[model samples]
Target: MPRTQDFDTAEVVGRARDLFWDKGFEATSIPDLERVTGLNRSSLYNAFTSKRGLFDAAVHDYLDRVVRPRLRILTDEPTRPDAAVRYYRSLAGALASLPDETPGRGCLLLNSAAGFAAHDDTQRSVVDAYQRELSGALTHALRAHDPDASTATLAHRTRLLTSLSVSALLLSRVNRDEAVAVANTAVEQLEEWRRT
Candidate 1:
């Protein structure tokens, strides 16, 4: 008979996610995961098959737990431009609240794109999918701002806004004030677009 797994997979994955988020995929090692997840090497291999597999699982869990929830806040009220503003503001707030010690722990998806995307097709695909989803959410919110706006215009603005949001996250590490300013600019632009 196959041996039953001994540890709680969810707990293990959560720990792995934190480790990956803190250190990133390229820097995080199998031993680090084993230590953080409280699993022996053999058990870790048995459960995840490989270090890459564990990282993949961790990334998926992080997106589901952290990223998707924030995106939901924007898309939830699809007809309110203020909802989009709230979404960006909330993201800025969350980044500002992170402990100073974790300075570069920006968006996990963005970090993955910078570090592992080119190295791994899977990572690249995940990042692209995330960008597309965020752009789609912003597009929906923008459409609500002006029912008469063309789909092409809304999509273009959404892509621009989403790109700005990611750039703000990166800049937050060096200058949080600038990061918040960038987000505010996006909000201001969206509001102006609504007026026109």
Candidate 2:
């Protein structure tokens, strides 16, 4: 039988995820991973196959740990009509709470969209799938908010809200105020729908 591993895979992924979140993939190096995950290069290669593999694992960890929790409010049973709004507010709080050092870290996948996703087919697909997932969750929440909205109207609103959310996440790593504004715009759009 093969030898049993020593470290906790989830813990290792989480540590590597934070390092990648702070520094983009290209910027993060083998030594960096070793430093963050406490796994030397050979061990890292053995466990993850390659740096890209580790990054992929980190990305999935981010989705399960960070993004999904936020999206759960939108997709969970008995979703509140104001869930989309609450999500944006919660997102704003998350952005505000980021330490000064990495205030512009934003969403990790969104960062990939700007960096690797733009040029790498695999990365692009990952970002695209993430967008679709987010859209679906937001659509579910929007439906709860306006049960009578026409299908076309709901579709349009979902697209707009999704765009705003993507913009907010991408901007979070650069300008916190603007990121909050973009996220709030989604909330404002929903409020407008409620009024009219």
Candidate 3:
């Protein structure tokens, strides 16, 4: 008979997600996962298939736990004129909350894209999907705010907000103030558009 999963897979994945979020995919060794998760190498492999498999699971966890919640600010309140601003501020707050010791611990998807995603098709696809989701949310917000906006205008704003959001996230890790500033500027620009 096959052995049942005696441990809580969610709990294991949560711990693994934190470690991967902190250390990136390539830098996190099996021993590191073992140490953090208290699972033996055999157990880890049996449970997740491989380190990359575990990392993929952790990336999905990050998306569900960290990324989706924030992205909701865009989708949930697409009609809100300040939805984009609120979204950016929330991101800034999350960035600010990170410990001072770990600067540049940016978005897991973005960081993974820069590192593991380049060489790993699975990682790259996950990152690409997240990016597409974000872009769609932005497009939704633009259309909500201005239902009659010209297609060209809507497309322009969507691209602009999507780019700004990615840039803000990357910058947040290195410099919180700069990231916040970028967000604030984008907010102001959006607000000005509303006023005019």
Candidate 4:
């Protein structure tokens, strides 16, 4: 008979997600995951197939637990676009506050995209899909608030704002003030779009 898995997969994935988020895909090693997940090398290999598999699982979990939930706050309450803006602003503020000693870790998906987009087809596809989903959520939220807005215009603006958010997260490492300023500008532009 096949051996039953001995650990909670979700718990393991959660730990892996944190490690990957902290160190990123390229920097994180199998030994690091094994240490973080409290799983032996053989068990991790048997369960996840490879480090990339575990990283993929961690990326999925992070999206489901962290990214999607944040997007949901906007999508679920589409009538309140300001809430979406405020939510994004708060994200920027939080990221800007992280200490310098911490490797300036950014969004795992975005970082993965920046570092691996050219070489890895899987990473590129995942990043593209994430952008599409976020843009769709923002577009849906914007339209819900202004039923008369043109679809093309709303889509363009949503893509622009989402790009700004991702850029803010990456840039916060170098210049917190500039990142916050960019976020503020995006918020202002969003506000102006609402009034139009």
TM, every model: 0.92, 0.95, 0.92, 0.88
What shift in Å separates residue 92 of candidate 1 from its native position after superposition? 1.9
Q: Which stretches of model 2 miss by more than 4 angstroms?
A: none
Global lDDT of each model?
Answer: 0.82, 0.89, 0.83, 0.81
Residue pairs with backbone overlap in model 4: none
Number of colliding residue pairs in each model:
0, 1, 1, 0
For model 3, give the 10-residue run with minimal summed lDDT: 77-86
Instruction: Give candidate 4 regions above 4 Å deviation.
Output: none
Best by lDDT: 2
- Expressed as tens digits, the lDDT of each residue in 23-113 for candidate 4 is 7788888889889999999899899999988988999998999889878856774257466576677776777687766545668788887
| Tens digit per residue, CA lDDT, model 2, 44-102 | 98899999999999999999999898899999898888888898889888777766666
Candidate 3 Cα deviation (angstroms), residue 109: 0.5
lDDT of 1 at 85: 76
- Write model 3 residue lDDT over 5-122, tens digit each, in one string: 8999999999999999878889999999999999999999999999988988998888899888888888994268567767767776776676667676678889887787898887
